[model samples]
Target: MDGLAGIVREAGRAGDRVGYFAALYRQVTVEVRTAVHGGLFDDGARMDRFDTHFGNRYFDAYDAWRRDQSGPRCWREAFGLLDDPDTIIVQHLILGVNAHINLDLAIAAARTSPGEAIHALRRDFLLINDILARVVVTMQDSVDALSPFMSLLDRVGARTDERILDFSVRQSREEAWYNAVLLAGQNEEEREATIQRLDIRAAVLARLIARPGSLVRPALELIRSTENDDVPAVINHLDNAMERSSAKQGTA
Candidate 1:
């Protein structure tokens, strides 16, 4: 949790500062491992191995002096979350969009079409969505953790605390930027863009849920019912389906 906390702290830094998140990513894996015990992990031996492997891959990359050379490529994908709040919000919206894709992929795979080999492509898309969702949650948590600071800045006297005011102003700007892009409702252009995004998501969901496997059984069952009419239930059902799939597949 320390590492995770560290990452969140770093993300709250001034917007002008780059590489803050990359540094945080380098450290977060360590904290994540520390948070997991033998009960949460596979076992002592397997956990040890996981710790070592993750350390080498993630830590080494995080430590790299050059973004292209030394750091883990995964961090590069995540760093944008810190740079812009709008991107952070987009990340969450994309999850809902991707869930739509998962549903579409599942249906598509079940259809048994023979035009082209979409199975692999759809699978890849679903996997990417799953991965990105985790990243989005991390970013969301980081930003949420900073909300108190935002409120604090609003109260501080600008004349007496110029430096703090400057910091507050920057944070306000960053947060506003993120909210405008992410939390704001969709305009026609944005909605149209989202529809295109939905197509890709649908393709992936169709591929994954096409089969009546245990991994997606819950989701498939829910879809078969009228429960998807409730947005919260749909999200919960999807989250449950993914969790079950991860447990079955031995994913950490």
Candidate 2:
């Protein structure tokens, strides 16, 4: 937790609005770092660069959005909800996941290759989905400790019988890679056009995360009542979940 994780922890301790997403992102960066160190890709250096670029988009948008500057539309919507006392922690986490994976990841992937060769990164691109999947699943449990009401989501997700909540994040990552390949094949103008369209779609998704309609919103509202306003504690839960996931991976 010395790099991104530590930075996120410090921010949370200071009640910075960006801390929750930063913690989630820290887990993702850690997973990529571990994957790179273990020689898990065709080009570790390239993966590192891609990962850095991907994470930096979120960081840059967080800064710009916080400062009321022009930024990615999805992130503008996502980060805009950070100041509301009614927004639950899980909503914040999901908003970050939606904006980062849905928008930033595609842009990063396309820029990493800048041509049809974006397809060459597919194997490792999907590997990132795996890492993100694991972190989110672990957080499903970790979040319960931070807020006792989060299990309401699990129950609601179950009753929905669609698995969309559980499935959307991974599905979004896959779509991100596909969109990246599409963007990679385009010229500058077409690429920007594609990104603008994707940004609109992603911003719509971010709104859903914040106000996800009748079936789930009531549960979320109830969950917000017992708010664990201790931002640092929530960040620690995320870090601990990452450590536990790594330990389990080591044993396995």
Report clashes for each candidate as comma-separated counts: 18, 0
Q: What local lDDT score does residue 175 receive in model 1, on the 0 to 100 scale?
A: 32
Query: Candidate 2 has what TM-score?
Result: 0.89
Please, what are the lDDT tens digits per residue for candidate 2 over residues 60-113? 886687577569898888878878888888778888888888888899989988
Local error of candidate 2 at 134, Å? 1.1
* Reference-based TM-score of each model: 0.27, 0.89
Worst 10 residues of 1 by lDDT: 158-167
Q: What are the per-model C-alpha RMSD values against the true structure?
A: 20.3, 2.7
Q: After superposition, how far is residue 26 of candidate 1 from its true place, in Å?
A: 11
Question: Judged by TM-score, which candidate is best?
Answer: 2
Whole-model lDDT values for every prediction: 0.33, 0.78
